[model samples]
Target: MRRKARQQTKAENRPRFWGRHAVAAALDNPERRIVRMWLTREAAEFLVPPKDIPVTYAEAADLARLVPGDAPHQGAVAEVERLEDMLLADLLDQAEDGRPLLVLDQVTDPHNVGAILRSAAAFDALGIVTQDRHAPPESGALAKAASGALETVPWVRVVNLARALEEIAEAGFWRIGLTGDADTSLQEALGPKRVALVLGAEGEGMRQNTAAHCDALAKLPISGKMESLNVSNAAAIALYAARAAA
Candidate 1:
């Protein structure tokens, strides 16, 4: 119980990012505020942490102590402040014509969210949206999974996902909900130049209300043998299809 309490308290405090890519990206992003960094001697030689931030040189074993258990820190770890909250309105205003918006409904796994962010960056997506309450917060595991895409992609969290869908429709995006039960395939639903792809949680799928908000319901064309793809893999495939259609 005490260990659980300690972990929770640490999560509530400044996030510590590990791995070389994650730390390098954090150092490169002008908006990111790195509180402190711990790097092995070899890693310190390559990563030029800002002079303003305190950096400590340590052995690989000592660096391991700074992050979560068995995390592949790759000789780098940094405590950082979370990025500022982004407004859904601002994201919509700044969106480009060919870039699609990705929305999440209760997809709470940090690693999945991070991989989705990586795919979003690869596809030149406008940004990603999620309900503030249901999504995972920024963390070391997430950053490592993202492999630096976390720094490049914009993530917007809102209070009401359904209401946010309404606003997205108002912004002229054709909101398409991805579900296995949908009669239409995703390819057929790709007519609109501006698209908003909404994906639900892994097993529970999208809530009824959330599905009702979409302009169309569609599913990926996959093999019959597999019941479902991992959410992150599905997201990458969906993003690729969206890009190909454009």
Candidate 2:
């Protein structure tokens, strides 16, 4: 109980956002509760804040102090409140336009997940689904990689990925698992249907159980010399293909 309380406290206090795009997006998001903002002179000029939010002007070194060591903050940092999590059912119910959803299976790399979010936003995906226990939390590295997409895209974290996939399947989406050994190409497998592209971790790929939940497994056409592409790269390609097909 004490450990859970401490974790809740930690999550509540850890809203430090950095980087120009990340900070700018947080400021722009109407739902985001801005605690305070620290900016270098150059970054300050570009940001116009509401009267209620506090602003602090500082030097580049000072801005860097707000983030981890060696982080590229781009002279902007903001401490804001975390956005509320979206329920799987709620997201599915609200998804009337049939936008594609990206499901990540135990892909813990923050940079990769962030890049996936960026691509999802570019392709106008409905949202991203991740297992809460296995996925990375909101952090500067993730926001930096995502650019501004972290603010625009919804990330739905669930307890069980396989169960979540089942829920997704029931929501009228065709779950397409991306695996290198699959018999069909992505384009051939995806035939103008609402889709949820499920991708797993870097090397291990999707778990056997997760694959079993998928309606179909498909692969991208790549050189035989390369066994697999990076998960983020694969996701971007899949999103583009889905968009083009739609």
Candidate 3:
């Protein structure tokens, strides 16, 4: 219980992010409030923080102590507050036609979520939606994996995923749930102008209720030898197909 409380506190407060890309992106994002930064002289040379932000120059060895084990900090580390909460309605209002929206159903792995965010940015996605309780909070590992995409993508966390899906449908998006058992191919389900690609966790896949919320269920065209793809890989493929279709 104490460990969980500590983790919750870390997520709520200023979390230290390392690696050049993550640190540089955070420094660039005007919405990001950097509490402090510790950087090697080389890292400090490139990452210029706001005039108000404090910076401490240190050696790479000293910087290693600030982040987790073998995190590849790349000589940069920044303690930053999380970005402000974003509303799903605001995202829907700003969404453009043909820009796919990626939705995660209980995808709790920070690495996978981060990779998905990178892919979302690559494909010019509108945004990503996830259940607040089921999603991983912003952290160093996730940010490093995203490689700066975390700052570029708009992420919205909702209280209830089903209700959020309902809202997405009302906003003119055709929700397609990706599952291995689905009979329809993603290509067959890709004719919609606005698409919301819903993916679930790897093994359990989407919840019954979550799948029910989608307009259709579709699967990737992987060979039968492979049973399933990682959720992040699946999201990238779905985004590509949706973009092509659009």
Off by over 4 Å in 2: 1-12, 96-98
Instruction: Give all TM-scores, in the order shown.
Output: 0.95, 0.93, 0.95
Write model 3 residue lDDT over 1-246, tens digit each, in one string. Answer: 999999888756777899999999998898998888998988877888877888898999999999998989999999988999999999999988889999999999999999999999999999999999999999999999899999999999999999999999999999999998989999998897999999998688999999999999999999989999999999998998999889
Residue-by-residue lDDT tens digits, candidate 2, 1-246? 999999789667776888889988988899888888888888878887787889898999988777899899888888877888889998898664447899999999999999999999999999999999999898888888999899999899999999999999888899999999899999998974689999999899999999999999999999989989999999999999998887
lDDT of 3: 0.93
Badly placed stretches (over 4 Å) of model 1 are: 1-12
In candidate 2, the residue pairs with backbone N, CA or C atoms under 3 Å apart (3 or more residues apart, or in different chains) clash, namely: none
Clash-forming residue pairs, model 1? none
Q: Provide the global lDDT of candidate 2 against the true structure.
A: 0.90
lDDT, candidate 1, 145-219, per-residue tens: 999999989999999999999999999999999999999999999988899999999888889999999999999
- Residue 151 alpha-carbon offset, candidate 3, angstroms: 0.9
Model 1 scores a TM of 0.95
